[model samples]
Target: MEDNKVDSKKKRLNIVSAIIYIPMFLGMIQFFFDENYRNDGLGWLLLLTFWVIRNIDQAIRDWWDKKQKSVLFDLLLAAVVLVFLIIRGMEYFSS
Candidate 1:
Protein backbone atom coordinates (compact mmCIF):
# COMPACT_ATOMS: atom_id res chain seq x y z
CA MET A 1 0.00 0.00 0.00
CA GLU A 2 2.80 2.45 0.82
CA ASP A 3 4.51 1.72 -2.48
CA ASN A 4 1.30 2.20 -4.34
CA LYS A 5 0.76 5.58 -2.72
CA VAL A 6 4.27 6.67 -3.61
CA ASP A 7 3.73 5.65 -7.21
CA SER A 8 0.51 7.63 -7.33
CA LYS A 9 2.29 10.72 -6.05
CA LYS A 10 4.99 10.38 -8.66
CA LYS A 11 2.40 9.96 -11.36
CA ARG A 12 0.60 13.14 -10.30
CA LEU A 13 3.79 15.13 -10.24
CA ASN A 14 4.73 13.94 -13.71
CA ILE A 15 1.34 14.93 -15.08
CA VAL A 16 1.62 18.41 -13.57
CA SER A 17 5.11 18.93 -14.93
CA ALA A 18 4.02 17.83 -18.37
CA ILE A 19 1.21 20.37 -18.33
CA ILE A 20 3.68 23.11 -17.43
CA TYR A 21 6.47 22.13 -19.80
CA ILE A 22 4.76 21.10 -23.02
CA PRO A 23 4.01 24.58 -24.28
CA MET A 24 7.53 25.81 -23.52
CA PHE A 25 8.96 22.85 -25.40
CA LEU A 26 6.81 23.69 -28.42
CA GLY A 27 7.86 27.35 -28.34
CA MET A 28 11.54 26.47 -28.10
CA ILE A 29 11.27 24.07 -31.03
CA GLN A 30 9.64 26.77 -33.11
CA PHE A 31 12.27 29.35 -32.14
CA PHE A 32 15.05 26.96 -33.12
CA PHE A 33 13.66 26.69 -36.63
CA ASP A 34 12.55 30.29 -37.15
CA GLU A 35 14.72 33.34 -36.61
CA ASN A 36 11.65 35.54 -36.26
CA TYR A 37 10.00 33.40 -33.57
CA ARG A 38 10.81 35.80 -30.76
CA ASN A 39 8.46 38.42 -32.14
CA ASP A 40 5.48 36.22 -31.50
CA GLY A 41 3.55 36.98 -28.32
CA LEU A 42 2.82 33.31 -27.68
CA GLY A 43 6.49 32.43 -27.87
CA TRP A 44 7.45 35.19 -25.48
CA LEU A 45 4.74 34.13 -23.06
CA LEU A 46 5.89 30.54 -23.10
CA LEU A 47 9.54 31.48 -22.79
CA LEU A 48 8.92 33.74 -19.83
CA THR A 49 6.90 31.04 -18.12
CA PHE A 50 9.70 28.55 -18.77
CA TRP A 51 12.36 30.89 -17.46
CA VAL A 52 10.51 31.59 -14.27
CA ILE A 53 9.73 27.94 -13.62
CA ARG A 54 13.25 26.79 -14.42
CA ASN A 55 14.91 29.34 -12.17
CA ILE A 56 12.61 28.62 -9.30
CA ASP A 57 13.33 24.91 -9.60
CA GLN A 58 17.06 25.54 -9.68
CA ALA A 59 16.91 27.86 -6.71
CA ILE A 60 15.11 25.26 -4.65
CA ARG A 61 17.61 22.56 -5.55
CA ASP A 62 20.54 24.83 -4.84
CA TRP A 63 19.15 25.74 -1.45
CA TRP A 64 18.68 22.10 -0.59
CA ASP A 65 22.27 21.31 -1.60
CA LYS A 66 23.65 24.50 0.02
CA LYS A 67 25.62 25.22 -3.14
CA GLN A 68 26.56 28.87 -3.45
CA LYS A 69 28.43 28.60 -6.74
CA SER A 70 25.58 26.88 -8.51
CA VAL A 71 23.16 29.42 -7.11
CA LEU A 72 25.29 32.27 -8.47
CA PHE A 73 25.44 30.62 -11.87
CA ASP A 74 21.69 30.19 -11.93
CA LEU A 75 21.22 33.82 -10.99
CA LEU A 76 23.55 34.95 -13.75
CA LEU A 77 21.78 32.83 -16.31
CA ALA A 78 18.40 34.11 -15.16
CA ALA A 79 19.58 37.68 -15.44
CA VAL A 80 20.78 37.14 -18.98
CA VAL A 81 17.45 35.68 -20.00
CA LEU A 82 15.58 38.50 -18.29
CA VAL A 83 17.66 41.06 -20.10
CA PHE A 84 17.13 39.34 -23.41
CA LEU A 85 13.41 39.21 -22.85
CA ILE A 86 13.25 42.87 -21.92
CA ILE A 87 15.35 44.03 -24.85
CA ARG A 88 13.43 41.95 -27.30
CA GLY A 89 10.15 43.15 -25.82
CA MET A 90 11.16 46.75 -26.31
CA GLU A 91 12.26 46.18 -29.87
CA TYR A 92 9.15 44.15 -30.61
CA PHE A 93 6.94 46.99 -29.48
CA SER A 94 9.03 49.83 -30.85
CA SER A 95 8.81 48.52 -34.38
Candidate 2:
Protein backbone atom coordinates (compact mmCIF):
# COMPACT_ATOMS: atom_id res chain seq x y z
CA MET A 1 0.00 0.00 0.00
CA GLU A 2 2.77 2.43 0.97
CA ASP A 3 4.72 1.48 -2.10
CA ASN A 4 1.74 2.06 -4.31
CA LYS A 5 1.18 5.46 -2.76
CA VAL A 6 4.79 6.41 -3.38
CA ASP A 7 4.59 5.21 -6.96
CA SER A 8 1.44 7.19 -7.56
CA LYS A 9 3.00 10.32 -6.10
CA LYS A 10 6.05 9.86 -8.30
CA LYS A 11 3.87 9.41 -11.34
CA ARG A 12 1.99 12.61 -10.59
CA LEU A 13 5.18 14.51 -10.17
CA ASN A 14 6.47 13.12 -13.44
CA ILE A 15 3.35 14.25 -15.22
CA VAL A 16 3.70 17.72 -13.76
CA SER A 17 7.32 17.81 -14.85
CA ALA A 18 6.40 16.84 -18.39
CA ILE A 19 3.71 19.51 -18.50
CA ILE A 20 6.26 22.12 -17.51
CA TYR A 21 9.18 20.90 -19.62
CA ILE A 22 7.44 20.18 -22.94
CA PRO A 23 6.76 23.87 -23.42
CA MET A 24 10.20 24.70 -22.17
CA PHE A 25 11.60 22.52 -24.95
CA LEU A 26 9.45 24.32 -27.46
CA GLY A 27 10.50 27.65 -26.06
CA MET A 28 14.13 26.71 -26.39
CA ILE A 29 13.64 25.90 -30.03
CA GLN A 30 11.98 29.27 -30.57
CA PHE A 31 14.75 30.98 -28.67
CA PHE A 32 17.47 29.56 -30.89
CA PHE A 33 15.87 30.85 -34.09
CA ASP A 34 15.08 34.40 -32.99
CA GLU A 35 17.53 35.00 -30.13
CA ASN A 36 15.85 38.29 -29.36
CA TYR A 37 14.60 39.11 -25.86
CA ARG A 38 13.97 42.84 -26.01
CA ASN A 39 10.48 42.67 -27.40
CA ASP A 40 9.52 39.04 -26.76
CA GLY A 41 10.77 36.34 -24.40
CA LEU A 42 8.36 33.51 -24.02
CA GLY A 43 11.27 31.14 -23.40
CA TRP A 44 12.51 33.13 -20.46
CA LEU A 45 9.02 33.28 -19.04
CA LEU A 46 8.62 29.54 -19.40
CA LEU A 47 11.95 28.88 -17.73
CA LEU A 48 11.15 31.13 -14.79
CA THR A 49 7.73 29.58 -14.39
CA PHE A 50 9.29 26.13 -14.21
CA TRP A 51 11.84 27.24 -11.65
CA VAL A 52 9.35 28.84 -9.29
CA ILE A 53 6.89 25.99 -9.57
CA ARG A 54 9.57 23.42 -8.84
CA ASN A 55 10.83 25.43 -5.89
CA ILE A 56 7.41 25.76 -4.35
CA ASP A 57 6.62 22.11 -4.96
CA GLN A 58 9.85 21.00 -3.35
CA ALA A 59 9.30 23.28 -0.37
CA ILE A 60 5.84 21.84 0.19
CA ARG A 61 7.09 18.29 -0.10
CA ASP A 62 9.95 18.89 2.27
CA TRP A 63 7.60 20.43 4.81
CA TRP A 64 5.30 17.44 4.58
CA ASP A 65 8.23 15.08 4.98
CA LYS A 66 9.17 16.84 8.24
CA LYS A 67 12.59 17.67 6.93
CA GLN A 68 13.22 20.98 8.59
CA LYS A 69 16.70 21.54 7.16
CA SER A 70 15.60 20.57 3.68
CA VAL A 71 12.60 22.80 3.98
CA LEU A 72 14.82 25.74 4.92
CA PHE A 73 16.96 25.11 1.86
CA ASP A 74 13.88 24.89 -0.27
CA LEU A 75 12.62 28.16 1.21
CA LEU A 76 15.92 29.84 0.39
CA LEU A 77 15.60 28.57 -3.16
CA ALA A 78 12.02 29.80 -3.28
CA ALA A 79 13.20 33.25 -2.20
CA VAL A 80 15.64 33.32 -5.08
CA VAL A 81 12.96 32.20 -7.48
CA LEU A 82 10.59 34.87 -6.16
CA VAL A 83 13.12 37.61 -6.74
CA PHE A 84 13.76 36.53 -10.32
CA LEU A 85 10.08 35.96 -10.96
CA ILE A 86 9.27 39.50 -9.84
CA ILE A 87 12.02 41.06 -11.92
CA ARG A 88 11.12 39.15 -15.04
CA GLY A 89 7.40 39.79 -14.50
CA MET A 90 7.94 43.52 -14.39
CA GLU A 91 10.06 43.44 -17.50
CA TYR A 92 7.58 41.22 -19.32
CA PHE A 93 4.57 43.29 -18.34
CA SER A 94 6.10 46.73 -18.73
CA SER A 95 7.26 46.06 -22.22
Off by over 4 Å in 1: 1-17, 30-49
Q: Give the lowest summed-lDDT range of ten residues in model 1.
A: 37-46
The alpha-carbon RMSD values of the candidates against the true structure, listed in the order shown, are: 5.0, 2.8
Give the per-residue lDDT digits (tens) of candidate 2, residues 1-95: 99789778877987887898787767756774674755246566667766777777787777767799998997888789789878988888887
Report the C-alpha lDDT of model 1 over 3-88, residue by residue, as the tens digit.
Answer: 78866866776677678788778866686567675446646745765886687567655765689888878878887887777777
Clash pairs for candidate 1: none
For candidate 2, report its TM-score: 0.68
Off by over 4 Å in 2: 35-40, 60-66
Candidate 2, overall lDDT?
A: 0.76
Query: Deviation in angstroms for 28 in model 2?
Result: 3.9
